[model samples]
Target: MTQIDIKVASSEILEKYFIGNELPLEAPVETWINYEREEKGMDVKMKSFCHLLFYSKLGSQLFDSINLDLDGSCCLIGTTILTAVRIAVDPLTEVVYSENPDRNFLKSNNFSYGIVVVGELPYSESVGDSTNLTIAEPGYDTITNVCEYVKCVVIIMSGRPVVIEPYLPKMEALVAAWLPGTEGQGVSDVLFGDYGFTGKLARTWFKTVDQLPMNVGDPHYDPLFPFGYGLTTIPIERKATQ
Candidate 1:
């Protein structure tokens, strides 16, 4: 059995073909950049703060590394030019370290289980709301990995709908526990099946970033979960004997 080499960087792969070659005279710089970005799935906007800080940094590095190999005669024109590009190649040992034990436990037990989401979902930290909020990579990894074992009922404790399209099909159930401020007892109660949760989606939950400007009046009206969509728990309404 041959082990596939995952340690190689994209730049390294490209360099093997074009490192010593001169840039094509007739090749359009903007067209090349656009084509590369599309092929690599890196469509980060230059002016966006979150993208500039996170996704763009690595993408810019990859592009710059390739750009340096181009002939000096080739004119590179873009919104931003990367001064320095850093590349590090390392073999991935473990994708999700913390979830390993849990996965093994689930495998050993082979029983139905539920997932209680405790992270702060797409919510504003300060005076204004933010856009294009997706679950972090680690969180996505954990959820998707866990889902592989068996069906899962996810309870998300966020103030708004999160981008769960890619992972949505894996999840059997979803609960949007929007900021139940101060009182966590209710949230706990719902998780333990002590209380029935009935919360509706106030806004649209987008499926992908391409489906942006997702509002009530948008021309492209497609969401993973539409507005006002809510899942109802089993009718187990019970009151304490007072």
Candidate 2:
């Protein structure tokens, strides 16, 4: 049987004993052997059995268990459950402002005024490993088309800077949110004005791939966005609801 099948079988066996019972937090190895022999009509001396303790909760909890391997050796293992919480987020409304408003296009066109473009570079497994610095295929093309329709904000999530100079002119704003992982609420907070935008570009954003191996203080050193470049904005206060 596969590992998943084993786990499922183990869980099924354990669930009957776990639910609606005031059993002790830990059970002895002998107890498991007795339970298996009596409940399933098996001879403990002839066959080996596996015992697993399953815990499903939101916070930290300790569990102790012992398994009898095929070689008649005892193995002890501990399992713990970590943090789990749900976050409630409100629906967001999109509003866009242009330098010169187009009334005719706004009435006829169904295109959105505000857009967010997420782009990334080729992923690498190792740190400091060299990979393609250019934003890959479909992402580059998608950003180009979206920017042409309306001024959009582009967010790049990667370990290092990428070549985005071609799409800079059309993009209204650009954010470098390097690998936020599971903390996406933090990004939405800033985008929705709940928080302010006060981040600065740590690395020099090059214009093209030809500028590889470029750094600060190098001769003819020019970049699309220089190091330590950031824009500051004030947080918008949420109005009280009646």
Candidate 3:
């Protein structure tokens, strides 16, 4: 058996080949070697090492023909739902953040529609997991109160399934936006009809916590939303603003 010192190799690779050198873009197999020789003064020993790393089967697979324009493309993606909703709806739409949200304002404004974002906080091993699957604290109460004034499209942002059966009757639409991370603009893209909703459920959503162990094949399986359940919508193109 042989034990290779990866740390030593990594340090050597970084210091010798990678340090102060911009990574070469997608090009011919000899691009790195040419780049090293022409752009940065190349050492013979370093050239041989780079050849070994670049010309190998794995290295060829790793670096060949990658789209270097991905960062620019991502930058052109949609804006957040908050910004989109405000632009598409009303620029003066009131923004409220409170434990006890004011229902009086909702009634007074008489808005046509509302968006409710409910979710569990980000959890880790040290702090432990959420015990309840229902929307926590003021979120559920707030959503309930808001629905009384205007129809709402609720977006659930948890990493796991949440109990939303109680609020289903009042909700005009529901979206399971499980952990969107930094690409919240994608959510807005769908919400604004720039893109269609094409996602399906990966797991069965139970009506209550009592059905904890239930699955798709269970004899007594009575799911609020069955596995693979999803709704689709056609993309609606927006006219360009003059």
Which candidate leads in TM-score?
A: 3
Better of 2 and 3 by lDDT: 3
| Ranking of predictions according to TM-score | 3, 2, 1
Judged by whole-model lDDT over C-alpha atoms, candidate 1 comes out at 0.48
At residue 52, candidate 2 shows an lDDT of 42
Cα lDDT tens digits for candidate 1, 1-242: 11112122223333332454422222212222211112245543222111111123333223322221122223232221111101222224222223233566657765455453533544355733656665544667667667778777665656656677777788887767666553344555655446666777778877876787688778879788888887766533554432
TM-score of each: 0.48, 0.53, 0.60
Candidates 1 and 3, the one with greater lDDT:
3
What order do you get sorting by lDDT, best first? 3, 2, 1
Tens-place lDDT digits, model 2, residues 20-139:
332232322222331122224544442334454444332222333334444444444432111011111222533333323344544455555444445565466774465457655576
lDDT of each: 0.48, 0.54, 0.61
RMSD of each: 18.8, 13.1, 14.1
Cα lDDT of candidate 2 equals 0.54
Per-residue lDDT value at 24 in model 2? 30
Off by over 4 Å in 1: 1-102, 121-132, 191-193, 237-242
